[model samples]
Target: MRGRLLALLIAIELPIGCVTVLTAATAYRTIMGDIEASQVQTTDDFAVRMRVWYRGALRSLLSFGATVSEAALPPELCGQAGLKMLDRARGFSAVLVRSADGRLCSAALDPGIDAQVLERTAASMRASPPVAPWKGVDLGAARYGQASIGDRRYLAVHAQNPAATGQDMQEALLLVAPAVLESVLDLGRGSKGMDIALVAPDGGIVANRGDTPPEAWLPRESRPPAELDRWHAADREGTERTYAARTIAEPGFYVIATFNDPHERDALIQLAVFLLAPLATLSLLCLVYLRAIDRHCVRWLRSIETAARSRSSSKRARAAMADDMPSDIRSVAEAFNAMVDEQEVRQRRLQTALDDNRFLVRELHHRVKNSLQVVQSYIGLSKRDYQDEARTALADAECRVHVLSAAYRFTLADGEMQPVRVDLFLEDVVSMIANLIRRRDQWISSRIETAATLSVDRIIPLGFLVADVASRVLRSTPGARITLSVVDLDEATIEVALEADREVAHQEPPRLFAGLLAQIEAVQSGPAEGRSLGRWRVRHHG
Candidate 1:
């Protein structure tokens, strides 16, 4: 039983472990996926804001340049007009109008323009003819560029207008301050350890703001992904980060943001702990339960087995089962003890019955022997007297006694006080009587047609009746043949008939014969044709 229980535990525990593992794995994947999606959404939001602001700045620069280029005013008046425009334009640091031949036509600056910055701008235009190869901007029309002068980066926008016929076109240059780009990239306000930057088409950092240095804002070897707006990758220092970028409209620059994902590993650890803690606790509980069973239940069962093997008295065995048994198994022990007690009671009853049967058998043997001996002595005494009538009566008495003795012996053979087969008993009695008469010329035949049984006391009188009737027929009709039959008339009665070959002397039955019939509650009905045939009907009083 313990082995079966252990197998059951294994079956249950294995499936529970499998289900726990599957649920934990699914939960971990689902939670991590949510975290990654949330991070990407945050990065995309920052990119969207930056894109909107950068496009607005470019549109402002274009409008300012277009206004200055189409003006038909005097050079000094144009310079004055450009200065007024600069005051209205928050992004532009300076506005300049130049001739097609690299000559400065008009200029406006908040802080007075430097000579070196002007010379450098002129030289760069001369070196690259129709469109300058600017450091930041990638437009072939030379419409936009990023220039550095005296450690200050400027976003330059140029626009040209042709004269009426065949003349040099008037050109306008709008120099945007670095602070305008700084404001566009400064949208990383919500999340910590995030860097937002505007990356030029040529892969240079135009402006950047974040927790890290400008060089570290974007990895050196990394290129913007073309397909996805947001992704994760390792930086030049092998630190993992999530990145998102959006293209700025007019200038075709990228607004990229990188965020350090602190929750990824921490969330994974939390998920593992959340999933495994219960399983570990369950395993511990199982172990504790097994130990408890071994301490209480298993030990109790072992004690029961020992008591069973001891084969002591029932009371001792019941005591052993009850002692030191756990409360949970107490009912089982009680039932077992009850069964043992009932068995013990049955065993005692059976032993007492056997003793009574043995005693009865001994007494029955003594009585039967004494009775047979007394009959034998009477026959001996009658033999010594030699009177024919007395001898005949004594011989008949002896024959009746012998028949009674045979009935007792036959019934007692089975070692029980039970009824004797009446038919079989009568058959044996008739045979014995015929042999005792010993007449060569006479033949006696008996038929027992009854299927009934009677007790020893009941059969005794019936035996006497059978023997007396047989003797009278033999005397009255010498050299005659007789047939005797016993038949069951009903459930409660039997009939005995005797038939002779010749008619006997018609005489009333003797007093002793009448008394024997009365003792058995029998009635004589026949003796038709001068007693040649007779029948006696007996009702079973028992």
Candidate 2:
């Protein structure tokens, strides 16, 4: 019993368990997806701020370079102009003017100038056209490059004056203050295990901060493309991280930030709780339901079944057991006992009514049979000594009486009250009419075509109509064959058609049958000429 109970509980819990697991899985995916999106958004916002800071510095330097070129000052006075420009620029560490022929014309360095950087800057300017500082441009006009000045690293921006049409091809090189790039990288440094880097066009690390080296954290090939803006990857430690990258307006340089995601571990814990909590709750509910059913329902049902089988003759035994049962079950037991008592009373009353109905039916059949015979006898007496036409009319009256007698006999043929078959009833009427007027010299043939059945009340009147019309047809044209047809037009209506071999003159129905014709919804007659065949059609109302 314990095994069976456990199996039942497992059967009920299995589907719910599956659903709980699926729900937990789906919830985990959703939570992780949201966390990923939030991380990407945070990184993207940081990238935007970095791009703004870099572009502003590039624009300021480009404007200052154009101003110096337009001044067209000689190499001797250019150094004084550079010092004045540095004083006005907030984040410029140094400003230098180099000529097209590899000569450093002017210099302004806060931490003092480096001779090697000046040579390299002059060399790079001669080799490549100036790369544009704005985004979406190929690296051709305005350029950004990294320079090692003494032991310290510096980022350089080189701009040329293509609009300067005279004298020498003069260009300006500005050394950006390291603090500017450091400030942008500092944004993500507050978070634990977070790293930030500025990458150059040739995959060189321009500036970076945090425990991991920028190159080891993100290889050049693994960097997110410019269009994607952000991506996810795992580092050397195999811990998954999200990375966001944005192209700096100055040529091929990009800003990228990486951080470890804390949501993944938290989501795992939430998913475990989500999967197990419902199962534990459901298991408890199942145990409670089993205990309740065994105590309140199963034992009471067994007792009821056992008492029923015992067949106790006393009502007290059944009542005492029923009173001891639960209120809900006790009410059911009372209703059952009450229904049995009422059914017994109904059976006795039904038997008495059956006996009465049998006697009434027999009496009705006897009286109807005797009355029809009396009327038939009266017609026989009245027809005596009459002429042929008068006798024929009396014979028709006797035939109608005989039809009513046959209808009563058929009604009684079936045990009690029953619907009469219209087709069979009409067939009998047609056969009787055919036999009544039938003679050796002049044979009167009849045919019935129908698949309809009606009750005795409806069939009797219908029979009268058919017999009256058939009788007239026989008298009007001797040796004529007649057809009686019934068709069900629909569920609630029927059509009856009578046709004869010869032309049937149109005559209004007798006063007795006028009411019956009114009961019919429609009547149509076709003459026996050309396409209008001789036929009488009657449509019964629904």
Candidate 3:
């Protein structure tokens, strides 16, 4: 039973475990995926802002390039108009020009001499075909190959001006500044605990208003991804950082941004509170449910067991006869109680039957004894005035009657109307026969053998038949020795034999007296007949 209970518990627990694991896994994956997708979306937004701002800056450079190429004035006047105009343009790093042959002609920067910077810008333009001539050009002798004034960075559009006779070098120069990109990056920051920046693909600082230079904000090789991608990495402080990066065409730079672990701490706390609050409530509910089950199920089972044990040891009827008990235990109690009831009823009935039978048997034995004695008196009375042979026959009939009475007496002694032992009945019969013949001056010795049991119905007739044969044999020769006995013939038959006494003189057996003969015939269906040892013998079968 304990094993069965344990199996039931395991069956319930396994499905609960499976459901918990599957639900947790699905929720965690879905929440993390949403977080990752939000990060990517934020980066794309930042990149789009930067793209718009940088495109404006590039248009500024292109306008300056067109004005410089269209200039038709003398070199000195062109220089004054162009220099004044470039200076008023905010965040221009330098306004310088190169001849179409790629030489510095007139310049606001390095007006006296230029060699290395122009050559480098020319070489860069030659190497990059897809980029505009303004791309990657060094405008002045800035150490980063560009100037970051305020938040804008600049490089020249062309290494050389158009070689028109008097074009100003100032108008030919294009400026790249970090300030425009920085403004865009700052707009994205918006006081959020996140970093935003635009980085050069060549690892140059393009624009950043972040707390640190964009390159130093993350690992050395880390920059905005060329397409939309997001990832998780550790910051220098060893805290988890999730980031998204994308490349923008207008800035010609990578826009990279990150969400700091601190930035997500509140969201995590809120999520934990959300998840844990309900989980705690559910756990309490589960415990309460289990307690209820124990109260209702386990306690009920224990109560049933207690009731069963009480019933086992108590003699009284199990309380209420268990009519409405749980089906499992009800059957056993009912069957046991039914057997007890049946046994008690049967015992009472048997006791009453036995007492009544005893009374009847005793009464029967008394009445039958009186009747046989009366019969013996009648035979004695009848013997007077009768012929000697008739008187002797009457005595024989009386003795046979006594033999039947004795057999019934045995039945009464057994105290039942049931069968009597055949062997014991024959023993009594033999003794009676021997005694009767002795009184008649017959030398009779009897031996009886039998295996058939005689019931009350047959005991009287069987004994009367044996007695009649013995009398006839004794009378066949007065003063003769006779042997009388019974033996089993089969399941349904008994055979009795009587031999005349050899000590008696031989004589024809006296004809059976009419009345005695008729009584013998009624029981045995024939008269006793035959002779042995020159003396008569009689045989009767019952």
By lDDT, the best candidate is 1
Query: Compared to the true structure, candidate 1 yields what TM-score?
Result: 0.50
How would you encode candidate 3's per-residue C-alpha lDDT over 1-542 as one tens digit per residue? 44465566557655765666566556666776676777787778887776555445545554554465456444576567556765777655444444343334333443322334444454554343222222344232211124333343454343332333443432233454446446556644344556776665465656555564445456434644647777777665555666678866423456777765443555556556665665666567666666766654555455545655665665444423334465654555566668767766887899999988878867877788778878877876877768676766776776778776777677777565656666787777777667555555655555656555556665666566556556655665556666666555565555555555344343444454334434433334233344543221223333
Q: Write the per-residue lDDT of candidate 1 for residues 214-276, one digit (tens) a residue.
A: 575576455655523777677767776777766543344556778665676777787778778
Question: What lDDT tens digits, residue by residue, belong to model 2 across residues 11-79?
Answer: 989999999999999999999889777666666666576667655666666566555555667666666
Assess every candidate by TM-score.
0.50, 0.47, 0.47
- Flag the better candidate by lDDT, 2 or 3: 2
**Candidate number with the higher lDDT (1 or 2):** 1
Error of 2 at 146 (Å): 1.6
| Best model number under TM-score | 1
Which 10 consecutive residues of model 3 have the lowest summed lDDT? Answer: 138-147
Q: lDDT per prediction? A: 0.67, 0.66, 0.56
